[model samples]
Target: MADLVTEIRERALALGFDAFGIAPAEARPDLGDKLAAALAAGWHGDMDWMAETAERRASPKALWPEARSIIMLGINYGPDSDPMAMLARKSTGNISVYARNRDYHDIIKGRLKEVAGLLSRRTGAEVKVFVDTAPVMEKPLAQAAGLGWQGKHTVLVSRQFGSWLFLGAIFTLAELPVSEPMAESCGSCRRCLDICPTNAFPAPFQLDARRCLAYLNIEHKGPIPAEFRKAMGNRIYGCDDCLAVCPWNKFASETREAKLFAREDLREPPLSELLALDDAGFRALFAGSPIKRIGHGRFLRNALIAAGNSGDAALLPAVEARLGDGDPLVRGAAVWALAQLADGERVRRGAEAHAGGERDADVKAEWAAVLPEVV
Candidate 1:
């Protein structure tokens, strides 16, 4: 059994995973209770799937009854530069480091499948692998596997690799000996909690996805709520403030995966250039990038919010051009941008022209809503 575990760990490292561990496939008794509390508090927000797969997600045994052991892996993709610096550069679109290169879902899934195939051949063990796309409770599972503890930010923070790990899991019918679970090392540290722009953390180790900029910019569809827009600053994709402030990050090695390297173009894209993208243009710009999955409408909505917060009056022309955009989401975001860029008079005049022709109820309310704030 020790030989099998040693072999699996060695193969994971050779395959580009920075860390590896194993956990029993038994159901975590506390996971289901914590999940129920979070759902009851509405912290899961608009991600309805969390509620839908509650039973399966909380229990590995429930997810795969035959699974007797689980293997956990981490890929370190730490940034070469300070991710927080981009926030002050309001003219540029701040894309999270993870999305600046190849979509990790594709990259990690391919690697997991490769390793799973090898393991199945070696041990004749039935195995299944997963990245983030599934309902797996990867953070807790990874902790139980001795990979890392869940930091106050609710992300896995490895003592060896820090906050910059992308996690994946494999379920196998073989009962490999379990590794000792990682101990909590976040004693007397609150940098992650203090750094949140939207006050997303209700307490240490808890997050409200409804107020999270990462959630708003990515998973969320339609117009962003007014309260979170300005706090979002120039971030057009996701937020990383909490992760960057972690002291554990110093131990993280630079990403070895060429596919995960930050793309020069996405590092700090000019907000004006990002605003120029129409539907076809958006698709072309983000092709093969995870940003493409959001589609043009939602992407444009985020770009427009960044434009409004940009404080660049020069962006007014680009903001106005979207008033008549085909998508209501884009148009609503544009209206908000206009209210921010232009003064009360210009915004009112622009609203009068578009309000009559604009058919979407949300767009109409958007123009109606912003008028009072500027006035």
Candidate 2:
């Protein structure tokens, strides 16, 4: 069994995985209680799927009854430049490091299958694979497998890779030797918590996704909450403040996987260019990237918020153009963004031309909020 584990580990490294380890499928029995508490507190916000998949997500055994051992693999996607610095370039949009390249699910899933196939052929064990899309609770499982420990910010932190690992898991019927679990090592470091623009962390090792800009800009389907708008800064797609500030990142290096590196156009795309994206243009630009999944309307909504926070009066024309967008979500956000860059007279003229025909209550409310005198 030890020899087989060694062989598997070698194969994983050869296939480009930077970290590898095994854990008993049921290693984290405490997950169910933790999940229930998080769900009960409404910390997950609009991500209702976390609550819906709670039972199966609680344990690998519950997810796959035949599974006896799990392999956790990580690929380092560390950025070559500091993502935090991009936040200050207010005319451009800031994308989270993870989404700046090709979608990781597309990259990691095939590698996971190849590794799982190797394990099955050696031990004649049935196998299953999962990426972030699955309700696998991968961060905790990665800690159980000794890839890293959950940092105070609740993201897995590796001594070697920091918070930059893209995690994937493989479950198999073979009872491989489990690796020793890593101990929490974030002593007195509050950089991640303090750097959050929206105070997403309720306490150490706890996250309230509702307050997280990454969740608001990505998973969230509606307009971002008003309170978080300015703090959202120029982050149109996702925020990397917490992940980029980790002291553990000192030991990390830029990723060797070329596919994971940020594409030149996406690194700090001009908000003006992004604002001009129509559905067709958006699809063509982000064809193989993860940002495409959010769809055109949501993309515009996010860009409009960034425009509102930009304080660049130059974006006024682009902001006004969206007042008649097909999606009310986009139109409403445009109203707020225009209000930020334009005077009441200009806002009133926009409301006069666009607000009268607006039927959506949300868009009307937006106009009313900005045009209180007219209303």
Q: 186-218 in candidate 1: lDDT tens per residue?
A: 999999999999999999999999989999999
Question: What TM-score against the true fold does each predicted structure earn?
Answer: 0.96, 0.98
Candidate 2 stretches with Cα past 4 Å from truth are 254-259
Candidate maximizing lDDT: 2
- TM accuracy, model 1: 0.96
- The collision pairs in model 2 are none
Give Cα-based local distance difference scores for all models: 0.88, 0.92
Instruction: Count residue pairs with overlapping backbones in model 2.
Output: 0
- Residue 49, model 2: lDDT of 95
Q: What is the C-alpha RMSD of each candidate to the true structure, in Å?
A: 1.9, 1.2
